[model samples]
Target: MGAMNTKVIEAEYDYVKPASLDEALDILAEKENVKIYAGGTDLLVKLKMGADLGMDIMMDINGIEDLYGVDKTADGGLRIGAAEKIWNLETNADVIAMYPILSEAMHLMASVSVRNMATIGGNFCNASPVADTVGPCMCYGACVELKSKKGVRTVDATEFFLKPGVTVMEADEILTAIILPAPEENTGAAFTKMARVRPDIAKVSISCVIKRDGDAIKDCRMAMGSVAPKPLFLGDISAELAGKKMSAALIEETAQKVHDFVKPIGDHGTTAEYRKEMAHLIAKEILEKAWENSGGELA
Candidate 1:
């Protein structure tokens, strides 16, 4: 077990820094109980809190050349390096212009210093239910690429999370990048969260994306955080509004459905009942805002 009751890491562990993607995969394949270190905003906190990671080696992925920078794909999509700093993504030009909701969420994710040291991959892999980026990423139809010595595979963001602090990644697999598809024309997204302060973990969070087709909802994706084991993707609920005309009555009815749908237990300094209520309100708030962005007015 790691040393407990301290605000600093005292455990003895060998740290390895790989130069390239292949080199990192080789180490991951060959090593036992190896943990990937990127940015270390979350991992370092765990170590300081004496959370037993049960690892023998810590692999620092920051040095890998392939795991840096964001690039636009040929199809007007984007490929975000897993180790790209949160600060960069929060302010990236393409992100701001193309995926505005994601950029907006990252801006409020944490304080400037922590964002400077936090990696997007590390943030997703940390698997916090209320992670600001994950909800927005999923809302935008993102996918995460998992690479390993054996090969690579892609998992849709909508299908990624299994539970709190857990993903479907294998032991030898490393999340190399996050890919986002081009948004359909007339599409818009909105994000909001409720926290105790300006810079605090969320008590409840919600994100919504809507593709408008002449004032009717052509398609929609909605997600709520801190109200379930993972960020709850309201696919079925979203489907209920697809191809339907926008109206205040419809939004209000769907909000009530959402209030009954989510199962929040309230572990983050709040009560279950409070989270449930806030989840409902936040859902309604984001949904209404997203509808407005999609060129609709409640009437």
Candidate 2:
């Protein structure tokens, strides 16, 4: 009789649950190859796939109280704790009333069960090009607050992502919260996407925010995902559309501008040409909805 040899899987790395933000920061500053663990929805999958992340220790910040709530800031903006679950934000009273565009994107991501396990901070930190939340957050003028033992610093969400699965976060810094400014009086925002199915990732997604003054647009902001290496915030194009009256011809021109500017990469999910077309289509729909919400009638 012959005996066969089999491979034994061994779990590597140590796990730490810090009691406070200070403790977490201290560990992060001192530990080598430290990876922050929040919801683990994305990180765990990467680890299983043997992504060369160089992680040797996983620091879980779930127990830190400061990283766990959705609160209103003094300036009427919302400060969302890093460890707050997606499900919490999806149903939070203030989040729904104040930033429903963000809620709309969150509601369309994954499934209910995955939402329960995913954290908003984790989503941003993962830096997926197709991350649903990033575009909404970008449209709303969000900022990310990062803390380490040294001190705390903030960066605009528009400047957060460097590329897919990469952010500007330093090794010792932890993303503590996401700060979203209050929507202006005349402003309205909306998010829409085209996906293979309800639960699938978007082929192209757009989030638009606009401010209307009588019959003319006072300002415009738009962000798109799955059409670039990172979420693309169309600042120049938005500037071009500002003060323009909303009309079918203008919308067509805006869509054309979007298609011309964005160069998305093709993958197994879709072709680059198809994604470019959908980027235009989704942007038009998002802009129309946002304009209507701002009390403008589509022409």
Best by lDDT: 2
TM-score top scorer: 1
RMSD of candidate 1 to the truth, in angstroms, is 1.5
Question: Distance from true position, residue 265, model 2, in Å?
Answer: 0.8
Candidate 2, 164: how far from true, in Å?
1.1
What is the per-residue lDDT of model 1 for residues 27-61, given as tens digits with 9 covering 90 to 100? 98998999999998888888888777987899999
Candidate 2 error regions (>4 Å)? 1-11
Candidate 2 has an lDDT of 0.89
- Model 1: lDDT to the true structure: 0.88
- Candidate 2 C-alpha lDDT tens digits along 228-261: 9998889899989887888988988998999999
All candidates: TM-score:
0.97, 0.95
